[model samples]
Target chain A: MRSRSAWTIFWRTVLGRAYPRIIGAQREKSWVFFEIFLPLLQVTAYVYIYRAIEAPPEFIGFVVLGGAMSAYWLNVLWSMASQLYWEKETGNLELYIVAPTSRMAILLGMALGGMFATTLRAIAVITIGMLLFHVSMTVRNVPVLLGVFLTTLVALYGLGMLLSSLFLLFGREAWHLSNLLQEPVSLVSGFYFPVRALGQVVAAAASILPITLGLDAMRQLLFPAMLGDLRFLPAEVELGILAGLAVLFLILARRALAYFETLARREGRLSIRGQ
Target chain B: MRANGSRSEALRSLRVAAWLGWQIESNWADPFVFAIYSLVKPLAGALILVFMYAVIAKGGLQSPLFPGVFVGNALFIYVPAVLAGISWTIIDDREHYGMLKYVYTAPVNVLTYLVGRGVAKTMVATIAVVMMLLLGTLALGVPIRFGGIDWPLVLGSAMLAFFGILLGGVTLVTARHNYGVGEAVAGGLYLLCGVVFPLDTLPSWLSSIGRAIPITYWVEAMRRALLGERTALFSGLSNGALVAILAGSTVVLAVLAVLVFRLAERRARAKGLLDMQMMY
Candidate 1:
């Protein structure tokens, strides 16, 4: 009966962790500074691009929205994941692991901290984008944009928590995996210009990543009139794809966590050395 | 013996340094793993840039200034990736099982000890830089030709080395435990310095801020060095004066590094961080 209660508690702990991963709510204001820097350079990049090209007003809005959304998701998954893995490798995980709280709570604390940091960066870059590029974001697009952002955030962080578990299971293999996440997704997500900008294969791969799907859908909503070419892909298509990948990632994440816990109990620690 | 003793002691420190810095010991990963870590980011980063460029280029952003992503990346885009590569070295000393505390307690001069460690870390990082450059030139086709450099390139190389030392010193002192902040600063500096666009490409106020960083100086120097585009602003300065000033700045930087070393030593000693090193 006591063991049943403990298992029930772990499930509850995970649901608690989901609040931030899903709702995008962490302690506000205190983390506003970190967001300032991430967007600072990105907006500068966009303004530089805008001046070089006389794209339609709509296109500039597309750049601002796409860049902001993608940067947030990319930082959450890429930078945050590796930072977590490094903390684990340096034996920082021992502290969190030994904490009287649940594993879900620890993952929530670190990942939420990272997500918040990245979000801070994303918001700063968006402000810069708006000021520099003269982006005109409309109220109509905000609801859909928020929807895509929140859902993708859940998917990406879920992937992150899962990836974090892998380090616990496999150790050093986690580092190698971290490198593979961001750059490839950056290409795929079409952060700089358009999906048509990448090769067909690269574009296809980017379309598969949740961040890319979310950004593409958000782009379509922002530019609702141009449904013809689907250069950025359609909204429902992107939402469906993003939602699908997020679920697939979560299920696989749970499986990976189970294997990792078992492997760690048997092996003592994850290997930091690459073989 | 006394007459020769002074001269021998000078030579002996050299010998001691040579012995200490040259070895690959239990802490060999301090250099080796970090070197491997440093090289991977740029190779991956360059490809990511190529992807971003491909996207923007296709999106009809192409113009004369379009090289901002492709050509400008050689100066700007690669810095962040390279920073991520050197990620592990920030706390390499502290992470070693009590080795930092042991290092702090040693009778050897703190300057000598850190210099030895720096020499080791720098050697590995330098090798990693070379490998990334080669990968950029040969494998990735990044137009960062060492041979194509002219007068401007000469000044640019000095500036890059200057920035490298500054960053290395910062790592030794600040954010040693949290390298991500330093890495972000390095990457952000590259973007702000207008390596992709002219400093005029950013907001007027921000571009002025970017000007103070050595990045714009080096980026212009690199372009003039490699591409041989002699802008009037750059060509107006006497090459000899620029060289002299840059050289002087570098010497001052080395002095600053020594000060950072002293600070690191004091911190390690005060905090009992040197209790972990074991020697035969």
Candidate 2:
């Protein structure tokens, strides 16, 4: 057989890894009901809560947008970060380790697949939430909104890629850690409201998460009139921060993946299930 | 004599299952990490509601409605804890641990075992509820009077186990191919049960759906016990009436749970699903 170039192998590995998620997304019917419909129920609860308090109409917009972006964060946490831990439990980690392809390519494939799947759900959430709650948005800059959204996904999934290695190293703690991160990250990232309401210092600390700034910037652009004073930073600065976060997380993820590969090779424990 | 012997055997199974469940849940982390894990998740959950209220309530924490919302949200830790706890045990044992077949062939009553398994989560959630309530009263001024709390109503609300077992029974049948059943049911209940907002705030149709759910009354009863106030949704009902309704609904739910679990167990055995593994 002819030897494939490294570039060809890398692309194939990416495509190969992503295939299951993209295809499973279509094959699985339950995820749609659970991911899309049930999440809408959660978003609806928040919308009703805002209505109960008689918060401004724009606050409803905030909840809907937060609900939309949260889909990606959840995808990052469960599908991307904790995925290798799950793979280990299912006895697939050893195969990936032995495969003659870059581990990063495998993760990248998972990220691409997860992003595709989550984007569908996120769009569904936003559309349904808007129609149901009548949430109005100004959308001052479409290019900027798309940029922030895409950058947030990149940085968020990059963080996921890094956490995947650490989580695999930690074994069962990965499950509890993922669960612990869920609500806390949502709270810190200001998923259901403007991050500014969390105060400057806390919001500044939370900026380590790409979703925090991304959501803030998107809200600023989407609800500029109402959130003029509520934004944590100017959209331009948040965009720059998100850009920086995207690059930083990707680099850190690569280093961590390398370290994880080295440690797994030395210790020979990464493939062990139920550690 | 026979009935007493059977009852004791079931109790033994339940007790052992509870111990095993606790070991599985806690042994993954050391005492310190486990403590932090227990503390942070629930606090963060409560803080989400707190911050949500803060972002909107012009009166801040001083809003008259804050206590009920805070108490309701705090107590709601039980729904996911118990519901998902029981259901996830089925998935954990069958898929992750690959021990469900052995468990089935054992002398333990699977139903009792499942209920026992949920006790660990209930205990953890109880701690979280107490912590959140303390945080609410001390730090947030939620106005919960320990002396004024109705202990009976609070205890009665523990009948939520019936609902969890009911969901677990459904999970037993569906979890072969569906892993999200527990969370989906819990999330749907979060919306329908008026955890953070009154059912009245939901559309009339959805509010009617909420009213039909026993958890709506359970949450309301819990809030009443904790806060000494009735949400508008159940304001017309007296305290005794609320208890009667909760007790009645709980009995019906318990019966349904047992029946469904028996049916599911029989079906799983007949269909060769008891040992089926999907690698999900």
Q: Candidate 2 on B1-280: residue-level lDDT in tens?
A: 9888788878988999999999998999888888889989989878887887887887877777788889988988898999888988898888788888998888777878888999988888888889999999999988888888887676556577887787777877775557677777888888888888878888899889989988888898888888889887688999999888888888898899889888988888888877778886
User: Whole-model lDDT, candidate 2?
Assistant: 0.85
- The list of candidate 2 runs beyond 4 A from truth reads A1-4
Worst 10 residues of 2 chain B by lDDT: B151-160
Q: lDDT score of model 1?
A: 0.55
Give one digit per residue, the lDDT tens place, for model 2 in A155-205. Answer: 989899988877768688877888888889889999888888889999999
Query: How do all models score by TM-score?
Result: 0.73, 0.97
Write down the RMSD of all candidates, one decimal each: 6.2, 1.6
Question: How good is the docking of model 1, by CAPRI class?
Answer: acceptable
Candidate 2 backbone collisions, by pair: none
